[model samples]
Structures are given as structure tokens and as C-alpha cells.
Target chain A: MIGFIIERIAFFAAIGGAGYIAFKGFSAIYRNIMLGRKEKLAGNLNTMLLVAFGQKKMFKRPIVAVLHFIFYVAFIVTQIELLEIMIDGAFGTHRFVYHLVEHIAPLRALYVFTVSSIEVLSLMTFFVTIIFFIRRDMLKIPRLSSIDLEGWPNMDAHLILLMEINLILNIFLMNTADMAVSNGAYGLWLSGIFASAFAGWDVEILHILEKVGWWGHLAGVLGFLMYLSISKHLHILLAFPNTYFTRQTPNGYLDNMESVTREVKLMMDPNAAVPESTEDGPVKFGAKDVTDLSWKNLLDAYTCTECGRCTAQCPANLTGKKLSPRTIMMKTRDRLEEVGKNIDANGGIWKDDGKSLIENGYISVEELRACTTCNACVEECPVNISPLNIIMQLRRNLIMEDSNSPAEWNGMFANLENNAAPWQFSQQDRFNWAKEQ
Target chain B: MQVKEMAEYAASGETPEILFWVGCSGSFDQRAQKITRSFVKILNHLNIKFAVLGKEEACTGDPAKRAGNEFVYQMLALQNIEILNGYGVKKIVTTCPHCFNILKNEYPALGGNYEVIHHSTFLQQLINEGKVTMAEGGLFKGKTITYHDSCYLGRANEIYEAPRKVLEQLDAELVEMKSCKTRGLCCGAGGAQMFKEEEHGRIRINEERTQEALNTNATIVAAACPFCNTMITDGVKGKDKQASIKVFDIAELLAAGQGLENIVL
Candidate 1:
């Protein structure tokens, strides 16, 4: 009875502890996002379903899509067993779900089928995770091994795969050990094949192994949950929310600056009444720091999976330019994380770090200048993150705040202001094409 | 071919079916002017009435907006919107993808909404309606032609099929480059690159695109955007393959198909 009481206490304590950490972790991310400028965004159910759930955009590469789908679907389906695990853990019972359904033949069959499928799916997950590892490490699939993921990001990918393997191994050991001790009570098919090997083992040893397996599986899951807050694996939790709030504007449509419009409206109509200058007047034109970016942009930075698909398709990057869309998100996330830590250290007050996102060893003006704004990166991103939008914002600051622009662009601006076009041609001669003919 | 200004249409109390937005390049660039003349010839041949914004037209502010100057962009955008709204322009067509994109997607938010269509889609519609009948064994009947997707007309707007279907009317074997449609490479001229030198890189984007076009073994390349045409032409010349390969706009191809090549500017 004491052992039973201790088991229940341990299970509940761990569960409560993991839940608290998750809450705290997610709240910190929310706080970081709140530090950014506000921009209205509405949730989209259809996009959420098609993009996040259906994994529609991923199908552009069939093989990678299939491999990733196994991980996704298996992750969801395997969670069903967590329900039984919790029940068994709380009650100090073995195979609590099997015992409940054993009385009904149909229910028994359904239970067996569900557990057996999870085992089979686990086997597949184990193999695919290995394959994904090989592709990343051995094959050096260009995007996975790109320079953008040289440090902790690379380790994060490998760590998640190893954790998945550990999780699967524990599930197999626990299920097989249970199958042996219960004498085929659960009727698991895949793990049952290895059940006989454990039949001759001491009954007590089998029970201990089963307990260890159960504890290991639970701890692995909790470990994964806690680690998600700091890993790229957070995409599994955030992709849904990210896709739900994705920008719905057309790819070609850039919202005109309302501040600029106000001035231009008055400039066009000199007789109009002058509006009051905003108390929070424009600060440096565009984004030089992460805080200058929109809250959604910071959300986009946190939600990035670092897949490098956007960079692979970028025209400038393909031609050996410095721009990489994946790095832009990574840098933004790193800076935001730094800001979050700084706030934590300073009693919830922010102090300037003397560092900014642009030209601060995070992103370079040369990289920004290389972008073609072709929307290829925007289209290639499976989660619909627009690195181009961030680039444009930084470019705005470079030109408006620092008066830093290429000579050619400055000339074009001058011509646009004078002749109503990008060239030196007089606006009066615009109809020369028709009159010449 | 007689092209009327919107003012002339208004003076005669006449309204045309479309306002042909001759972008700055179409008016000034020597090479782009040919494309403008070819499109006008087709409209004249079909007896479809169209008017231009003439001198009252200004830049759509696409390059300035892309170059990160919002003030200059909005200054031009407001002025253009005022003129367009004053003319009560309802439908617009342009050969330049940049102009078409800005007008169709960006203008509505600033109160300058109109039925803006790229000439590729416009031509596709005309051909689909059987109004653009091609002569038998047309100029490109036996030639192997590949279509290059302009970024503004393609991923930016998702109008991939219109240009391809228009090329189908040429009765030629339409080949596709390795990178076409959504994956189609840029001609290194987007985002105001046409108005400035390219940022330093190992290879120019247009050169890479030209090599893809050459790999397809297509004698003629069809493009929708004037900027793409210019960049690809320069790329082919850089490789000294200009003698064997020709870059023509869909409008020029259609004009040649209808025996309207004599309409020269």
C-alpha cells in the first residue's frame, strides 16, 4: 500500500511539475511577443486546417513530405496511449485499460487494435527518425546542414531524433514486458512477437523491468515537453497558432504606411486641416531592433522551424549572395531571447543592450541589399512566414534613418520625384510612343 | 493604328473597353517600345477601342516602394490615384507585370480600384474566346518555344496558366525550363534591380536563367514582362548566343502570328 501511495504521489508530482514549466515557458514567449509593436491579426480556421493540420504545402517534395507525415501522424496517434498510462500511473494498476475492456469482446478487440497499431507506428517512427538522421548527417541534405544551422540548431535536430528513438524503445520494452507478464492479456501483435523470449525470466525481474520501462517512457515524454520550450521542436505546438494568424493579404500587396499617407493627403490637399502629430511619432522609420517589428513578426520568428526551404529558393542566395531567409528568423529569435533574459535579469525593466538586429553581427545590410523581393521565399515557406517583410523593414531603417542607400537607388529616387518616373525622360514626352507611330 | 488618349475619349463623350496602361518602360525604352506597338496593332486589328493615360499618367510607384522609400512611393501613388479616379477608369490593361501588379493589388487599398489585368491574361482570354484566330502555320508554328514566367505575373499573382495557354495559340511546341511557374527563376530584374546594378554575387541571376532557357533547346523564348525580356536578352548576348536564340514578348509573338509585323514605331 505504501508503494502504491508513493507511485501515485510521484506520478502526480511529475505531471504537475511539467505542466507548470510548460505554462511558464509559454508565458515567457507571450511576454516576448508583447514587447513588439502591435498589429491586428485575426485567426483563420481554413488556413489552419489546410496548412497546419493537412500539411498541404509540404507535399511539394513527396518523399520528404511522406517521411515527415509519419512523424506527425504517429506523434498524434501515440498520445492516445498517454491516457492509459495516466490511468495506470494514478491507480497503481497494470494495464488498467485492458482490464476495463476485457469483459466486452468488441471493446477488447478495439483496445488490442489500438495498442498494436501504436506499436507498429512506433516501429516505423524509429526507422524514419534514423533515416532523417542519416539524411541530415550523412547525406548532408543541403538545407539541413547549411551554415545557418551550424551550432545549437543542428544539435537540436539531432537531440529531438534521439529522444524520439528513446521514447519508442521504452514503449516497446514496456509493452513487450507487459505482454509477457500478462500472458497475452492485451494481445498486442508487434510487441507480442518478442514476448516469449521473456517468458522464462523471473517474474519479479519482469515486473521491475516493466516498472522501469513505464517510468522511463513517462520521464522521456516529460523531458520532451520541457525541452520543447527551448527547441525548434516548438513548431509542433506553435505551427497551428502561427498558421491560424498568418497574413491573409495578397503576396503582392504591401500595406501603404498610414503615417506617410497622412502627410501625402495633406500635401495633395493644402487646404485640408492639419492633423495633430502623434505623441508616439515615428522612431527610425523602420525596424532596426526586434522591438520595432510587429508582434506577429516576432511570433513568426519564434515559430520558425529553421527548415531553410526559403533560402534554397531565394534567387540571390542561389547566386551566392549573403542573404538567407532562415537565418533572418533565427537571428530574430536569438535577439528576442536575449531581450527576454535581459528583462528577467533587470526586474522586468528593459535596458538598451547596445545591440540591434541589423548590423549587429546578427544580420547585415549587404544581406538585406541582396534580396530580390521575388516572393519566392514567401511562397516556399511551408508555414507562410514572410522573411521579405522583415528585410523590407530593416531596409527602410537603413535608408530613412541612416541615409544609407546605393548611389543608383538615390538617383532613381530623385528621378521618381522629379519626372514622375524612374528615368530621366520628361513626363511631357510620355505620349511620344503613340505620336511617333 | 490609332491610339486615343483618355482626354480624347472624354471630349468625344466616348468610353473604351479598356485603358491600356503604357508603363514608363513601354514609353521610353527603345526595345520595350516595340512590344507596346505590337500590342496596339493587335487591338487595332481586332477593332477594340482602348485609351491611354497619356501625359497625365505617372509612375505606379512600384520601384520606389520596393526600394524602401515609402514617402516617394505614396507621393506618386496618391497623384496617380487622383488622376485614375478622376478619369473614372474602370478597366485597365498593361504589358508590364510590375505596373499590373501594383495597380491590381496595391491600388484598391488607396481608393484607386479598377479591373486591372496583365496583358498575358488579357491575351489568354481573347484567344480562349476565339476572337484571336491565328493563321495556319504561323510564324512560330514549327519552332520550339519555351515560356519564361515573370515573377510579378507568376508567384506574386499566381497567373501561370494564362501565358502558357497564350503560347499554345502559336501552334508551336511549348517547352518548359527546369525552373518554371512557381519555381521559375527571376531574370535578376525584380525589386527595382532594373534601375540599378545588381549586388555583387558569384553569378548574375539572369545568366543562370538564360542557361536554363538554353538547356531547354528552345529557339525562341516567350516572356510576359518587359523587364524579363530586357534581362534575358542581355543574358543571351553575354553568352553570344543571340544569333541563334530570340527573346520576344507574347504580344510580339501574337503580332507576328497575325501578319501585323509592319506596325513598327
Candidate 2:
């Protein structure tokens, strides 16, 4: 009795510690997102439902989609089992929910059915995860094997798969060990076969085995929960809000700079009436650092799955230019995280670190210039993340503020300024084709 | 062929059914002019009552805006809008996807709104209305022609079918590239890259896309945008395949199939 009571106390302590750490980790991410400039993102329920919950874009590759769906469904269904484990550990009793509901025959049958289904789903999830591992390592899929995922990203993926396997094995261990001790009293469907192997084993030994399973499974779940905030696995939670908050405009529309629009309208006609400015600081042209990007852009950086789908479809990447869209999102997230740490370390104020997203070790001028703005990457993202927008934001700063466009682009701009076309032909001669024909 | 300028229509107290926006490439490029004339020939045959903006039309500033020069983009956009609004132009059609995209999608935000249509969609409407009758056993009859999807036209605006439907009217076996429609690759000319040298790379973007078009084993590749036409034409030549595999604009193909373009080939 005393051991059971002690075990309950230990479970609570472990869970509380993990829960607090997870809360802190997630709060840090929220602060990092809030460091960005403000832009309105109204709720889009329909987009959220279709793209995020339905995983609509994943269906483009049907085989992998099926594999992923099985893993997702398995994870959700296992939460029911998780709840029963929590209750059993807290109350110093084995299978507490089962015991409470075992009296009503129909409810008992419901319990049996639910546990059996979870076992079958778990067994399937086990295989699917292994296949995903094999696909990543052995299949040599170009996107997965690209230089973008060479070091820590690759390790992150392997660790996630290994953790999933650990969680799954511990479930079977707890169930099968319980069946061995209870002599079929539990009646969990698939684990019963393994339970028979311990028919005449010592009861105390079986009890110890069940205890180990209980503790291992509980620890694994809590640990994974905490780890998600620090890992790319955050996508499992972020995909929902990211889809809802994605910009609602057509994929091609870059919102006009309100400042630039005001200048141009006034220039075109001196009598042009413009709205009064709401000035807090001098208006900067475009994004020079993480702080200049909108909050949603920062959120997009966190939500990236690092799946490399966008990189595979990018024209610049295909033609061997320096740009890879996936790398753009990854760099943004890295820089944002670094900036968040800077704020935290300096008495809650941001201090310039002499680094920006576009120079000397982050996204580069060559990468920014290489983009064709073709919308292929935008079209391919399953989570509705737009790396193209980030690239354009950085390019806007380079051009409008630094005047860093190429000589060829400068020539084009000059021609448009004087001749009203990208070339040097006179506006009066626009009809030359008609006359010459 | 005779055409009336929008200024003439305004002076005569008349309004044409549509304003034909002749983009800079269509006005000045030697090859694109042939495509312009072909579309004009078809419109004249249909008696569509279209008027050109002629010399009064400035560039739509597509390249400038895409290159991150908002100042230049808005400068040209507002200038053109003043003239368009002054004449009360109600409808517009253009052969270039860049112009069509900016005019249709971007202009409204800057106070220059009109009913805008690409020539592919416009030509498709003509076909659907039973006006663009194809001559039996026309010039491109039974030929294998694959259609290239222009980035601004196909993906940006999602008007893939109109160009393909127009190609189907040629009585040709219309094929598709390996990357077609939504997954279509760029012709390496978007985002103002046409005016600048390409970045250092293993190969050019246009050649990569052109190889996909060639893989379909079609005798000809059809394009909807003038920029795509130029890029792919250059791409085909880079392979030294011009003698066997030709690139033509959808407008030129449509006119040639009707025996109306007076095609030299």
C-alpha cells in the first residue's frame, strides 16, 4: 500500500515538472512571434478546416499521404488510452476507468472494443513509422536528401521517429505485462498472445514489470510534450493556426507599401489628397531584420515542417542558383530564435547584434535575387506557408532602402522612368509595329 | 489591316466594345509583332469593334513592380490609370500575361479597375460563342502540339484551360509538358529577369523548362505569353532543334488554323 502511494506521488511530481517546462518553452516562442511588426490577419475558418485539419495538400503524393494519415489517426486515438493511464497512476489502482465502468455489461463491452481498436491501430502505427524511417534513409528521395537537411534537421527527424517507436513499445509492454499478471482478467485483444508466455512466472516479478511499463509510458508522453516546443515537431500544433492566419489574397498579390503608395499618389498629381500619417517612428522602407517582418511571417517561420516540398518545386533551386525556399524559412526561424534570445538576455530590450537576415551568414543577396517569384513554392506548401513573401520582403529592403539592385535592373528602372517602358523606345513610337506591319 | 486608336474613338464620341492593350513587347519586339498582327487579323475577321490604346498606352510597370521598385511601378500605373479613367475604358484584353496579370489583379488596388481578360480567355470565349470557326484540314491539322503554361497566366491567374481549349480548336493533338497546369515550371523570364542577366547556374531556367516541353515528343510548343514565347523560342534554338521543333504563340496558331493569319510557314 505504501509503495502504491509513493508511486502516485512520483507520477504527479514528474508530470508537474514537465508541464511547467513545456509552458515556459511555448511562452518563449509566443514572445518571439510578438517581436515582429503588426499586421492584421482575420480568421479564416474554411481555409483552416480544409487545408490544415483535412490535410488536403498532402494528397498530392497519395502513398505518403496514406502513411501519414495512419500515423496521425493513431496518435489521436492513443490519447484515450493516455487518459486512462493518467487516472490509473494517480489513484493507486490498476485500470481505474475499466474498474469503474466494468459493472454495466454494455459499458464493459465498449471498453473491450475501444482497447482492441487502439491495439490494432498502434500495431499499424509501429509499421508506418518504420516505413517512414526507411523512406527517409534508404529511398534517397531528392528533397529529403538535399543539403538543406544535412545535419541537425536530419538528426531531428530520426529522433522523432525513435521517440515514436519508444512510446509505442511501452504501451504494449504495459498491456502485455498486465495480462500476464492478471491471468486474462484485463482481456486486451492483441497483447494476450504475448501474455501467455509468462503463465507460471512469479507474481511479484510480473508486478515489477507492469510498474516499469507504467512509469516508462508516462515519462515518454510527458517528455515528448515538452520536446515539441523546441523541435520542428511544433508543426503538429502550429499547422492549425498557420492555415487560419495565412494571407487571404491571391498567391501573387504583394500588398502595396502604404508609404510608397502615398509618395507615388502625391507625385503623380500635386493636388492628390492623402491620408494623414499616424507616426510613431520614421517610416522604414521594408524588412531589414526579423523585427520588420509581420507577426504572421514570424509564425510561419515557426510552423515550417522542413519538408523540402517547396525546394523541390523551386525554379531557382532547379537551375542551380543559391536559393532554396526551404532554407529561406529555416534561416528566418533561426534568426528569429537568435533575436528572441538576445531580447531575453538584455533586461527585456533588443540590442542590435550586427546581423540581419540578408547578409554575412544568413539568407544572401544571391539567394534573394535568384527567386523568379513564380509562386511555385507558394503552390506547393502543405501548411500554406509562403517563403516567397519573406524573400520579397527582404528584397524590398535591399532595393528601396539600400539601393542594392543589379546594374541591369537599374537600367530597366531608368528606362521605365524616362521612356515609360522597360526598354529605351520612345512612348510616341509604341505604334511602330502597327505601321511597320 | 486597319485599326482605330482609343483617342479617335473618344474624339468621335464613340466607345468600342473593348480596349486592346498592346504591351511594350507586342509593340516593339520584331517576333511578337507577328503575334500581335495575327490576333488583330482574327479580331478584324470577327468584326469585334476593338480599339487600341496606341501611343497613349505606357508600360504597365510589371517588371518594375516585380523587381521591387514600387516607385516606378506606381508611377506608370497611376499615369496609365488617369488616361484609362479619362476615356472611361470599360473592358481590356492583352496578349501578354505580365500586362494582363498587373492590369487585372494589381491595378484595382491602385484605383485603376476595369474588366480585364487575357487573349487566351478572350479567344476561348469567341470559340465558345461559335464565332471562331476552324477551316477543315487547316495548317496545323493533326499536328502534335504541346502547350507551355506561362507563370503569370497559368498559375498566377489560374487560366490554364482557356489556352488549351484554344489549342484544341486547331484540330491538333494537344499534348502537355511533364510539369503542366498548377505544377508548371517558369520560363525563366518572370520577376523582371527578362531585362537582366540570369544568375550563375548549372543551366538556364528556360532550357530546363524547354526540355520538359521537348520530352512530350510534340512537333510544336504553343505559348500564351509574349515573354514565354521569347524565352522558349530561345530555349529551342539553344538545343539546335529549331529546324524540326518550332515554338508558336496560341494566337498565331489559332489564326493560322482558321486560314486567316496568312502564315509564311
Candidate 3:
């Protein structure tokens, strides 16, 4: 009875501690995402079904898509087992669903089939994780091993793969030991093969091994939950919402500036009444930092899976320019994290920092100008994230706010303002070609 | 070779069916002027009543808006909007994807809305309506012609079939580049990159795109946008295959296929 009490206390304590940490981590990320300006969201259900559930864009590369789909389905299917494990851990019960199988004959068959399928899927997950590791480390696929992905980003990918492998292995070990002790007919296909090695062992030792496997798997899952808010794995939860609120405008359409439109109206109609600015303070023209971006952009930063598909398909990146769409998303998320920390340190109010997203070298002018704004990056994103939009916003700040656009661009601006064309020709001679014909 | 002004039609209490929005390149660039002439020949042959903004037409401000100069873009857009509104123009057609994109997608927000169509689509409609007919065994007959997808028309506006259908009427084999349609490569000219020197890179985007077209081994590389035409022309020159492979706008091909090659250039 004392041992039972001690085990129960320990299990609940681990659960409580991990739950608290996970909640706090998620709340911090939520606060950071809320810092952006709100925009209307539409087509939520359709987008979620197509992008997140359907995995529509992942199929662009067929082999990887099939492998990833197996892993994704396995993770979801195993969640049913995870719930059982959680209940068993909390109550110190063994095989919490064993009563259902014992009571109903049809349920017994169903339970056996389900457990067998889970075992097969767990093994598939193990192999897929290994393949992912090889692709990242041994093959060093150019997209996966780009220079911008060095340091923590590279380690983060490796760590997640490693965690997945260990989790699947523990699930297998628990099944093997359970079959060894109970001589169970269910879950005995793959587990039976491993159980033979432990057949001669004492039943008590097999029980202890099963308990250790159970505890380790549950603990690892909880740890992974807490780690997600800080890792690129955040995409697992964020991709759904990110894709739902994606901008519905045509890819080529650049939004007009309202201020510029108002000025143009005044220019066209001299007697037009100018509306007073309703803003509480002076309105800044474009984005210079994370705060200026809309909430959808901020959500895009969090939704990035660092898959590098965008960069791989980018014409600018393919041509050896400094612009990497992956790097743009990474830097935005990093800068937002810094700003989030600063706000947290200042008791929930942002304290003016000398450093800003652009000036602090988080994203350089070279990278900004290198973008061709072809929307290829936007099109390639699996979660429908648009890094091109953020790049355009920063470029707007560079040109309008700071007058720091490239010299050639300034000349074009001048030509457009004076000649009403991108060239030096006069508007009076616009039809000269037709006259010559 | 008569191109009436909208003001002339307005003064005569007459309105043309469509307004030809002669973009800057079509109005000024030497190479693009040939495409303009060929399209005009098609319009004349069909006897379709069309007018032009002529001196009143300004740049649609596409380059300015793309280059991040909103003030200048709005200035140009508003000026052109005033002129277009004064003429009470209803429908517009242009040979430039840049102009087509801006007028069709961006102008409505600036209070200048019209039924804007690219010339490729316009010609495709004319052919379907039997207003324009191609000759049997025309100039482009029995030739393999690869169509280059312009970024603005293909991906930006989702127009891929109209140009291909126009090419189809010429009785030519319509070959496709490896990357075409929604996955089409840019000709290194969109986003106002036409006016500025390309940034440092291993190979120009147009050079890469052109190489793809060459790989198809088509005799003619056809394009719809003036920018793509110029870039692919330079790309062909760079490969020293200009003598072997020629670049022509779809309108030019259609004009030639109609035995109006004398009006070309």
C-alpha cells in the first residue's frame, strides 16, 4: 500500500509539473502572436481541410510526402494509446482498456486489431524517423542543410527526430515485455518476436521493464509538449490557423497605400475635402519591426516548419542571391521572440530599445533588395505562409520611411513622377510608334 | 494603319468597342513596336472599332508600385484614371502583362475600373468568334513553337491557356518548357527589375528560363508579354542561337499566320 501511494504521488507530480510548464510556454507564445495587428479571417474551415488536414502542398515531392504522411498518421493513431497510458499512469492501473476487451467479444477482436495496427505503425514511424535522419545528416539535401540552418536550427531538427525514435522504441519495448509476462495473444505479432529473448527472465523483472517503458514514453511525450513552443515543431499546432487566415487576394496584387490614395484624390479634385486623421499618434508608413506587421504575418513566423521548400524553389536563392525565404521567416520569428522577452521584462509594456528588426542586422538591406517579389516563395509554402509580403513591407519602409532604396530604384521613381513612364521619353510622344506605322 | 483617339470618337459622338491601352514598351521600345504593329494589323483586318488614349495615356504605374514608390505610383495612377474617366472608356486591351495586371487587379481599388483583357486573350476570343481566321498551311504551319509563360500573365493572373490557344490556331506544335504555367519561371523582368541592373547572381533568371526553352528544341519561342519577349530575345542572343531560334509575340505569330507578315515590323 505504501509503495502504491508513493508511485501514485510520483506519477501525479510529474503530470502536474509538465502540464504547468507546457501551459506557461504556450501562453507566452500566444501573447507574442497577439502583439500583431488584427485582420479579418475568412474561409477558415476550407483552408484547414485543404492545407493542414489534406497536406495539399506536401505532395509536391512525392517520396517525402508518402513518408511524412505515414509518420503523421502514426502520430495521430497513437494518440489513442497515449490517452490510455496517461490514465494508467495516473491511477496506477495496468492496461486501462483491458476491461472493455474482456467484456465484449467483438471489442476483443477490435482491440486486438487496433493494438496490432498501432505496433506496425510504431515500427514504421521508427524506420521513417531513421530515414529522415539520414536525409538530413548523410544525404545533406541542399534545402535541409543550407548555410542559414546551422547551429540551433540544425540541432533542433536532429533532436526532434531522435525524440521520435526513442518514443517509438519505448512503445515497442513496453509491448514486448507485456507479451512476455502475460503470454497475451493480442499485440503479439511484432512483440512476440522480441518477447522470446526475455522468455527465460523472471515474471517480476518483465513487469518492472514494462513499467519503466511506460513511464519513459509518457515522460518523453510530456517533455516534447513543453519543448514545442520554443522549437520549429510549433508548426504542428500553428499550421492550421496560419493557413486559415492566409491572404485571399490574388498573388500579384500589391495593396495600395490609403494615405497615397487620399493624396491622389485631393490632387485630382482640388475642392475635395480632406478627412482629418483619426489616429491617436503620427502614423508610420510601413513595417520597420514586428509590431508593424499584421497578426497573420506574425502567425506565419510561428508556423514556419523550417522545411526550406520555399528557399529551394526561390529564383533569387537558386541564382545565388543573399535572399533565402527560409531565413526571412526565421529572422522574423527570432526578432519577435526578442521583442516578446523585452516586453515581458518590462512588465507587459514594450520599452523602447535602441535595436530594431531592420537596423539591428536581423535582416539586412542586401537580403531585402535581393527579393524579386515573384510570389514563388508564397506559392511554395506548404502552410500557405507569405514571406514575400513581409519582404515587401520592409522594402516599403526602406523606400518611403528612410529613403534608402537603391539608386536605380530612386531614378525609376523620379522617371515615373516626371515623365509618367519608367523611361526618359515624353508623354506627348507616347503614340510615336503608331504614327510611324 | 489608322489608330483613332478616344477624344476624336467622343467628339464625333461615337464610342469604340474597345480601348487599346498602348503600354510604355509598346509605345516606345523599338522591338516591342513590332508587336504593336502586328496587333493593330489584326484589329484592322477584323474591322473591329477600337480607339487609343494616344497622348493622354500615361504609364499605368505598375513599375512604380512594384518598386515600392507608392507616392509616385498613386500620382501616375490617379492621372491616368482622370484621363480614362474623362473618355468614359469601357473595355481595354493591352499587349503588356504588367499593364494588364495593374489595370485588371489594382485599378479597381484606385477607383478606375474597366474590363481589361490581355491581347492574347482578346485574340483568342476573336478567333473563337470567327472574326479572325487563320490561313491553311500558314507561315507557322508544321513548326514546333515553344510558348514562354510570362510571370505576370501565367502565375500572377492565372492566364496560361489563352496564349496557348492562340498559338494552336496557327497550326503549329505548341511545345512547353519544363517549368510552365503555374510553375513558370520569371524572365528576370517583373517587380520593376526591368529598369534596374540585376543583383549579383551566378546566372541571370532569363538566361536560365531561355535555356529551358532551348532544351525543348522548338523553332520559335513565343511569348505574350513585351518584357518576356525582350528577355527571351536577349537570352537567345546570349546563347548565340538567335539565328536558329526566333522569339515572337503571339499576336505577331497570329498576324503572320493570317498572311499579314508584311505588316509585321
TM-score, each model? 0.97, 0.98, 0.96
DockQ of 1: 0.78
Model 3's i-RMS, to one decimal, reads 1.2
* Residue A5 alpha-carbon offset, candidate 2, angstroms: 3.0
Query: What DockQ does predicted model 2 obtain?
Result: 0.78
Tens digit of lDDT per residue, candidate 2, span B47-78?
99999989899999999888888889889998
lDDT of 2 by residue, A1-437 (tens): 79777887898899899999999999999999998998988979999998888989899888988888898888888899999998887777789888988898888888888887898898999999989888898997889888888888899888899989888888888888899988887778988888987789899898888888878888889989999887888888999999999788777677777788788888877798998666468888778898899998899999998988999999999999989999999999899999989988999999989989888588999998998989999889999999988888888889899999999999999999999988999998998887776
lDDT of 1: 0.89
| A1-437 per-residue lDDT for model 3 (tens digits) | 89889999988988899899999989988888889865566757787889888899889778999999998899889898888888888787888786547678888777777777888999998899989998998999999988999999999998899889878888888989999998865555788788988978998999899988888798789889988988999888898888778777888888877877777778868888867665457767678999888888889999998999889878778878788999999999999999999999999899988876785869888888877777788878989999988888888888888998778888888877788878889988988988785
lDDT of 1 by residue, A28-66 (tens): 999998899878888899998999999988998889999
Error of 2 at B173 (Å): 1.0
